[model samples]
Target chain A: MSAKPYNLTYPQLGNYDIPIGFLVRKGLGLAYTSPPPMTKQTIELGAKHSPDYVCAPFKCMMGCYIEAMEKGANVIIQTGGTCRLGYYGELHEQILKDLGYDFKIMNLTLAQYGGIMGILGGIKKYAPKRKWSQIAKVIPTVAKMIKSIDKVEDYMRKNMGFEDIPGSFEKIYKHFLSKLRQAETTKDVEELYHLTMRSFSRLPVHKPDDPVRVGIIGEYFTIMDPFSNHEIEKKIAMMGAEVHRWMDLSHSVLSCPDDNALDMLRSYAKYDLKRFPSSIWVDSQRKKIKKYVSEDMGASSVATIAMADHYAASGFDGLVHVKSFGCTPEMDAIPVLHNISADYKIPILYLSYDTQSSDTGIETRAEAFYDMISMRKEARQS
Target chain B: MKKAYLGIDIGSISTKGVIIDEEHNILASVYLWTEGNPLGASKKVIQELASQIDLDEWTVVAAGTTGSARKLVGAMCNASIVKNEITAHAVGTTTLHPDVRTILEIGGQDSKIICVEDGVAVDYAMNTLCAAGTGSFLTSQARRLGVDVEEFGKIALGSKNPTPIAARCTVFAESDLVHKIQMGHKKEDIIAGLCNAVANNYLNNIGKGKKILPPIVFQGGVSKNEGVVRAFADSLGEEIIVDENGHLMGCYGAAILAHGSGIEKPFSFDVADMEFVTREVICENCPNHCEIICVYRDGELIDSWGNRCERGVIRS
Candidate 1:
């Protein structure tokens, strides 16, 4: 078969810079595009054309796919999932084909065929020029780059508030990403990692004696997307508090399964709450984190309560809970959060976001919440 | 001195505000139509709340804002805590009915289903995109029928043999209603069918994929309609409870959040007197032209956000 040059497009979640950057470094794909940001036009188009009563995210993705196809994207790379999203790829492909868009779709998530060879085979279908050995050579380097990116983000989450100058971590983080994209070897990756970590460590900073720390608890998609929650964590952190967010794709898919069994055992022993049966391992880990960690485990109900309890126990003075407009897991957690708020006597802020593109309203509320918590803290001290 | 807490809830249709004591007792509450101006309506609600409470006797210490406009009103009131309507409503309703398992909230523009497990919201869904299930759709239909919106429930309840109206989208429902009237169907029967349509629309849309258990609380503006309430009760085969203060749940939750915040500071009614304006500008950076909004407080730029890029950081 003749080699056909293709560009891949993935669904937009958080910042696509790192993922896009990773793809570029490997030279597997010529170019990539993140789905267009959800806007009024996007929603209107999606709702008008999509099947009535489908989940909002489905319509959103469909809208993005249609727009991307119009923008001259030839090949789309979709991941498989356990949820309804997994089935969406096939339907989307069919719809796009019906619309007469000539393109190739690379679905990474095939059923239960778990192995690196499968993934390699899938990619090779589009890029037949690259040998398996050549692709294998880039894996370790790509893994190192991912590690470096996660480490920088982890450090920034904890110490970003303490920086003497605002935007210091952000500046260094940008440079770190640039360096990671340019690195061709493990040694280069290691050098850049150390330099980024050193800059993060040495950045001018002062730790507050008792800052108003808050943990962000929410659904996976809304929590990761800054636009959805109006960049709430950053807003709360800007109020001079260390913000902790434990939910991410890396944590949920990569780390949570191993920690789940241990967490379940801890929960059964401590809380005697045998409620979580969805995933025994996840429940147990949630329990252990709730009991042992200073912050919440970032599950559905447990995430909110843990955040509330930690804020109060740590004397952080406040908590902020955010979710998509209609997320199910969070709806179940709100009442328990009420009792925790009452018992701990720490203020909690709740925000539900839809597709509205206005941030003026969000900023105003965050500012007011900060002012209230700060004044309350000052009053208690006085 | 007795300390007071302020709570504000801004929804698509209305803005509500409430002042409560440390014991969670409501001192003053105000509800008014939003009129497409959340900023103005919130200011009015706060001013009215301030007028009811003695500024000297009770010091407004901690404040909270919730609902759709929580962020905007929270900023206007300088709230200590700003939360979502789910948390706010769950907190507010649970305080009144500790065993509430389900919360059905239908407002002018949207509807939501919040599932509570052990006094906490665990699962929830909201319908903002579809108009068929919300109160605004009902109100517009009531106007077309030349029936008073307030009497919708009574008329619905009076029906003996309800006529079937095509109740899917607002357009289809309107045409169906017109057809039913031309066929000489009784007004009360048509009204009853409209109520059923509302309930059916909600169940299929917002209530989809939810295992709705009861000790359910029906809230928001539409809860006032007895016919719609009966339809929900009939459809679910469970009794629906509508609190007298259900419309104020968002504000009530905000008050409770503020009171529990443990802040002690005096509030100034000067918030109502302050001038705030929002200006929207499009970002020219890259292909995505993001419209950024800048909020100015008394000629000083308090905050600016909207552009995905740093191009629109500076304002002229």
Candidate 2:
């Protein structure tokens, strides 16, 4: 246990921070401070402290940790993953300590915990004053909040472009998020979710019957975080295309994998003993893209390929494969993406982002891609 | 009076302009270096184009803009359409060569490959996170060799045995070129090798997994280099077509688009005489620090952009 009163913070990943903060404050009985909203300065700070060759997500997280510490957070949490992300916790701790920050790193990767119970116990150690029953009471609300956030965003991505009033959907979305931040119970989240959905539907939209649809699939972190990917989803959606993305906390983590598929996928992992997170989704996705990939390509490659193939087969006009620069797992999936693009005859824009702040290149490419797809659609119809 | 449409492609290294009459016939064209001044370069292009065409006979009704400075130039010209270079090039090339299946473009600092099917672009890829295998690289290498960039093609054609240079990155290729120079390789051979390196790098990077079928059209500033053309031909084992007006294709397409758009925003050569200026204001409202660009004409703000939020809006 930390000697100081626990004030917790985690790296930002889109709006997922809201639910995480809810959990830490309500469930764990610890003071939770949401990391400062990401900006150019955050990225610059992160990049300055990070190793030159490390993936961009590491740099982003590093920046968040420093800012959170400066904002009075003494406990930082880092999660484990299958890729280099699995080792980020230790490195972040070492680096932060070297920088002379007095903080406790609740490195989940180093915790001798296995699955659901393990995660609970690991977090329980910091909230010694709070009973397990009290913590258990808040889990449902946290889960509901995550699902509601994803649901609202999915609708926004699909319909934001077509709204009659330019910023109508965005205004509602912002309101929902602000209201969500103040919600205290499951009923509050449920009511806010229903009200937001209703408001979204009531907004006047000029959607076409056969609108241009673009699917986005890529590395988990970069794909989810709008800041990291330069708000690509919003950019494309605003360009009058319906954007669909299947990789999210709800799909990848909240949903349980089938036990049978878990057994099959475990053998594919080098260490068969570790609990397979989201194995069912990966296994199902792997099955769909079996011809393109023979086995697991590691990290989120399976989800990326499977979602891409799904989008292509379902008659999507375009696909965007986004990844941070020097991301090996996503890089390995490029050959498979190429094959899918060929087989489906769908155009895929490969966007690899580094720490460079200039968005001109991204805008140019995205505009061109939108033009090409919309023109192709017109030609097909004519 | 004959009605014409104007198009301008203001790129990083060069600015090209074209005026086309009905039926997409080129009435006048101009090409010049941007020299880090898009506004100045575009003004000069317009002036040169105006000099070539008789304003008394033909009235330019609509204008379009393309390339990196499309928005800036578009706003300045009151353009009917401002399209990206990829689509503009594809449309222009496909209009000229209806059967063209591939369009290869290597501009000053960027390169892209657009795959066409039935006269429409179906797939495309641009060089990402790198400016390698582009025209500016070749120009720099030409300067280092103490040779005019325009003479590179003819000199490369003279080399029987081209020295092999690294094709992966600009830095690697530079070091390799220096090493071969120290190793006593001939200038012509090294130049030829650099041309080949560009073609190979383009193929390995932008052209990766893209189908480069027949009726391929190679255009852009670099396309004028016969060495790169030859190199592309050799690497792909396919005949590459370079049009006489390939460099003007972006502007030509823009003109076509403006004409097709049916929205007439009267274009006048008087824009060349107008004082247009742009100022960059770094918004200190928040941490994003968006560099909002405000465009002015005769010292009055006309259009402003680059602000991501309402807080950064610059009111004139």
Candidate 3:
């Protein structure tokens, strides 16, 4: 007989838990597991086996899927999107199958057929033991869990740096995650969410009589994925400065397209006087969709520039722009960034990430840059 | 007043410096191993250059820095201009050879091909991803063959019939060299084969799909290897120019850039006496803990970086 219960695994994206939770409550799985975090080794392994010169994210996901297989995940779930990521599930499945791995790939994304019913059917195939009635009973709980996690994270990000004490957010965030993991009922999940939000709200923040604030701008995946960008926010915060980042998923989905365009315009205006210049164009529609669907997908040049302007106006210290290697949008955005860096006299540190094992060289470079900016700030103050 | 400019190029494997007079003629030049400590290496380079020149005849009006550690070394020396190797090399080469159409630089760690027209670089490609065609490759192969790297060129020149070795990647090249050696290939022939392999690898990787024209000046640490220079000449079917000051091109370019920057204030050599140290702090911004580095001089931070964001600016 097949295993009585199983956990479902999916590659990470913006707020993936909500969808995973939704599927699990519908009686398909016991726990929703995110693939292991992407790392240098992950990228290296992925690139070694993957087709040469594909986008970096493709290699990253390939690595994540291969790693998950190694972890004894029997069934894999993949979400379909407009970008090439939508088709990645099929390719990943085929590659893994050729390697003689025994697993089922549940692809929710269908190029020809797409709807709520379609996704439900896909989940049902993997979760054969769960009755449809039982599956129906769990959806609300999963939705609540997702909402709770996203809300708490959003609140923490905006206020974490301003906390009166160091490690306060971290302390509460750990408790929050543990509670989230153990949450059995919708009410329990809701209660945990409220507590986390409260802790976030209560974080002691003094309006810096003269705060050095910085905006972090970059590609969505690298910007949001701490591993990819090298924990730039923490470094910036440790510098006794406030930090701002505007590339969250909630902002992308809830906000209208016009708002995104307007935001882009506001940021671009700083460097170029012309409004809404279409700088980069990819021939691949799937690539474009991948960028559009994710809030900070591709190179988040506009968001970074806008946030940098905001931080600069707010008397922030500097800006940091991070991108994966060979991100074209960022390459196009750099000239404008140079102009903004000069115009505001705000130092901007640009970091490009690849799958190299060594972090020593990167650390040395960062140390020197921080010292230079800090010295400048001190010089001005004295 | 005879004005002079100082340019320093601190790379991963070597440190180079050049002192240039008002006319951009090298007054003093020095090259040494970076020895894993850029600050110390730079200080030594500065002292060596100082000892070689008359301080009264030339006052350093500005200082420039270029290379991977340019920023750190630039900060240490109060550089008027800190540019990337590409810009620095282009400027330096264009100044020395006004009609140069291409600049090929294969250094210890990296290789670059610059397409120049009208004394300005139009396009360029740099190979930081591979180690097959760089000076490090030759150094490793020299170690394997029990030959000193300094004698690599002379040994290659002695080869009458160089063996044909695979030149695609380092692993394949090593295997091919081993196979050829087992087949009773002469040491000189193997050395020549290795030189040719490096040239072929560079042409296939960095020089692919580019218009490589003559008036080509080869520069960088690897340019000192006459075997590789000869290999390049044979591969391209053209005579390659290797200047006596080729290895100093990066520093020369930086110095030229510094002079033309229009910064009139004289540079002081007081940096040699200052004590600088690098400190690292873990940035707990998110799950990816980035170790931000900060450089301090006499207990005061001069610069910090290594963060993906502007988060590690905490100064006491």
Candidate 1 per-residue lDDT over residues A236-338, each given as its tens digit = 7766777877665445433333445765455434421122221223553455445433433333445455445655666666667787666556666666665
Q: Between which residue pairs do clashes occur in model 2? A: none
Using TM-score, rank the candidates from best to worst: 2, 1, 3
Scoring the B chain of model 3 against the true B chain gives a TM-score of: 0.96
lDDT of 3 by residue, B1-316 (tens): 5889999999999999999988999999999999899999999999999999888787898999988889888877778988777778878888899899889999988887877666656446566446777899899989999999999999999898988899999999999898988999999999999989888898988776566899888888888888889999998888899988888889999999899888765577777778999888987765446677788887888877766545555654
TM-score of chain B of each: 0.92, 0.97, 0.96
* Leading candidate by TM-score: 2
Off by over 4 Å in 2: A1-3, A110-118, A256-277
Q: Give DockQ per model, in order.
A: 0.06, 0.88, 0.05
Writing each residue's lDDT as its tens digit, candidate 1 over B1-316 gives 7878888998888888888887788899999998989889988998899889888898888889887767666666677887777667777887788899999989887777777656656455565435676898888888988988889999999998878777667788888889999999988999999998888888876676566898999998899999999999999999999999999888888789777767644567897999988878777665456777777778776766666656668564
Regions of candidate 1 where Cα sits further than 4 Å from its true position: A1-136, A143-173, A190-382, B116-122, B165-179, B208-214, B283-290, B302-316
TM-score of each: 0.63, 0.96, 0.59
lDDT of 2 by residue, A1-382 (tens): 3577889999999999999999999888889888899899999999888899999999999999999999999999988677888889988988989899999878776344665567667878898789989988999999999999999999999999898999999999999999999999999999999999999999999999999999999998999999999999999999999999998998887663434756645634422223234454676677767788888877888888888998999999999999999989899999989999999999999999989898888998999999999999999999
- Best-fitting candidate, scored by DockQ: 2
